[model samples]
Target: MKPTLVTQTALFIFSLLLYCAACPAQTAQPAPNQTAQKVYVGAYVMNLYEINPDAHSFYADFYLWFRWKGDIDPTGIEIVNRIEDWGANDEPFSDSVTVLKDGYNYNGLRMEGRFFHPFEMERFPLDRHVLDIQIENADYPLDSLVYLPDTANLIRMKPTLRLPGWDIEGCSLTAKTHMYATDFGNTDLGQEPYSNIVLEIPIARPVTYFLLKLMLPLIIVLLSSIGALVIFPSRSYVDARISLPIGGLLTAVFLQQSYSDALPDVGYMVLMDKVYLLAYAVIGAVVMEIILSANYLKRNKDTNLHALRRIEWYMALFLILGFLAGNLLLVFL
Candidate 1:
């Protein structure tokens, strides 16, 4: 009986050894509870990336990184934009994708991730847009940690918003964000330059010139109005000097209000500001002219109707005609 028992034990042990050799012991997997992925976003400057007139063709390129902790590889993140026009098939212009690393596979782990040329900008010129990126865990698992950008080990990316002449309006950014899966913990919330585009504008001047916009037009109008005072002196001769600029001052006040709505409230000079300063000086000249004329013509000298009238007519005639001639040169030359 002992001999028989020993033989059976030996057979069982041999079978066990074979099983171990054939199928190694499996490492455990976490519970089926899925977690939403986390990702970091950044933008860099290069004089590259242009969109054609039709907006359908784009020559845009930028590197996006997907970073995470607890044994995560690049396969964890995906740049999820629809390839409708390109149609997912490999056509000549059908949206190309390339990676920095070729012939190197991460074997299910790569924190250094990049997605290039995933899709074109947009088909419409005037339409606003964005690209949505989704991230997930492909290998290993990471829980929360206590540090900057926490647990992501992202080191960082370069040159935050407003690329080259791309000053954002209001600096308010005009972007909206919605977060999901935070309940399970993705500490990397919405961040700067998370969304980026070259803005594709042929001219990137300031949308609203706070300093010089109204000032330019104001100078033009004020100059013209001063010439008008020189022209209309016979009609209202009592306050010839102060009349034009005072009226201009009121008009300028209204113009300034209009400018306030268009530009931010700030103290700085621009082309517009310089032009308006010229206008102010012109208006002040009109005021000074009136004061000097009043003193010379006399506070109590019987209103020299004929002599004053003659002076007004010729001065206005010469001044107005000269201004018009000069304006033509200014406009053309």
Candidate 2:
């Protein structure tokens, strides 16, 4: 009972199909990428109590948390931007982990510590700053663990959170790979990138503070200096006019020093410093005008007193307008 040619051909075709199906099962597939573990990180800021521009730091109370699956534990996190203070930080859940109903592991801790941020004071009272709480896993490199911001609810701040001199603008969260230049003491591993999560809080001073507290006093001092020009250009008024500008000069210096003490000593001048410089210049100019007028009165006996009075008026108007315009340009532009 030998098979026919057509039957033999059909048998060979079936055998080839079977072999093709079995080849895929026997051959090995490429391995999946299992180098990094994905971690979702978030923060709920309860309060921001102290912000010191001179110290370049701010005190914050917040809850930091992490969520992830599998066996990787990313709870051992460190605040990279935190200022070290012995026995100051309060972390109650520093050693606990919870397994959620969906099998994802969770861990959180309350942090009360000072965080460092180099504040940009070019604008001073008008300055806006982003205070950040940067976190990183000290034990895990970026290759082993990567942070993902919980975009659904990344940043949550308390409804009534407030800072004394600042207004809370908004908040945000971001994840990044922070690469270190040195590998600490590990010469074999070289430098490795670390997963970093930052919770940022944007804050700015209220415009009312700038207007009422800072600029209003400065304007008063400037006007007082200009008032010296309005006095009579006579011999009796010489002492009064000359002394008025001098007094204003002293007050302006005192005002500037008072604010400067609140800020760090930086090489460059801030906006408020520039404004004070203008004030000083205006006061000096007033003194010069008064001196010239007095010399004319002594030598010529109020010969061109009318012209001198007119010049003084013009000078006063010019200084006032110039100061206002300069301030506007410095602030808005």
Candidate 3:
């Protein structure tokens, strides 16, 4: 039978709707970034026992925890720490893995490992350094895996935690993408990328330790050298004056040697070195002053003895002030 025009129009519209629905409804393009895995990191530092600035390394005993949400088993995944000074002792003391029905993976361990700490020793004893414990995925590139700081689960020591000469200043956690080049022996690759999480602990050394151990004794010796100028004016007295400064000079040499044994082999001079140089100059000046003063006394200048005493006072004051000024410049500037 022949259909009317309106009925034919309705049938045409219905057919088109059915064909479109059958083909497929357009869905939002599956996000390209949905497959990326993010690993969360947390740590509790148990102890930091040894710190060797000369070696530029530190030892830390810590507990680490990792978590991620993924369908695949995380058991095969490896955790890498970039700050490892040596390859030995990288494994954790006790490691455990857990997988939940909801597709979450948890990994935790307690480990004591030696990590590398790059120290800034410009100020040496007065310097503050940030010690970093860095971790990342060894096998996965940044495209596949990333690390995040798990601030919720972070455990840290109090600021009171300190070594004999160091005080814990602060602590922080951060995560970022780290990129570097890999050498194939023949040529360098474009770039290799990894996700890094860093736990930073800042430590400071007290200035009083330096003052007492190094500066104080040197100051005492310098003061003792002044005694040379105050002694009786006799021909034999020149020997006493000479011996005083020479003894102080030797003591300074000994102290410097002992101190240097603990320091790194850096090329630049440090604050302590400057102080020692100043001390040596002062001692040497005193020796020279004593010689000149004794020669004047040998000329039977009893009247000029008072003038020599006044000169002695002037020399001591000048040396002391110069030492103080030099220290200020070295420390503050």
| Cα TM-score per model | 0.33, 0.82, 0.74
Clashing pairs in 3: none
The order by descending lDDT is: 2, 3, 1
Cα TM-score of candidate 2: 0.82
Worst 10 residues of 3 by lDDT: 72-81
Worst 10 residues of 2 by lDDT: 24-33
Model 1, position 232: C-alpha lDDT score: 35
TM-score for model 3? 0.74
What tens-digit string does per-residue lDDT give for candidate 1 at 145-255?
Answer: 111122233222223433332332211111112123333453463211121111111222343442255335665666655664454333346455466668887787677
Q: Could you tell me the C-alpha RMSD of candidate 2 in Å?
A: 16.3
lDDT of 3 by residue, 1-333 (tens): 356888999899999999988996674322213467877777777678688897788877766677788653232433344355454344543355676575667876666667777676768667888888777665666667766777776456634456767887766778766666553363554455666778788888887878898889888988887667667545676887789989999988998888888888888877788888888988989888887877767777454666667778877888888888988988889
lDDT of model 3 at residue 131? 87
Ranking by TM-score: 2, 3, 1
Q: Tens-digit lDDT track for model 2 on 1-333?
A: 356888999999999999988885652222223678888887889989778877899889988788898678887788898897673576756466788898888887888988899998899878999999888998988778888888778448988887888899988888876778787899999877788889899999999988998899989988989999988787888888888889999998899888888888888988888888888889999999899888878888638777888889999999999989988888889
Task: Note the Cα lDDT for every prediction shown.
Answer: 0.39, 0.85, 0.73
> Which pairs in model 2 have colliding backbones?
none
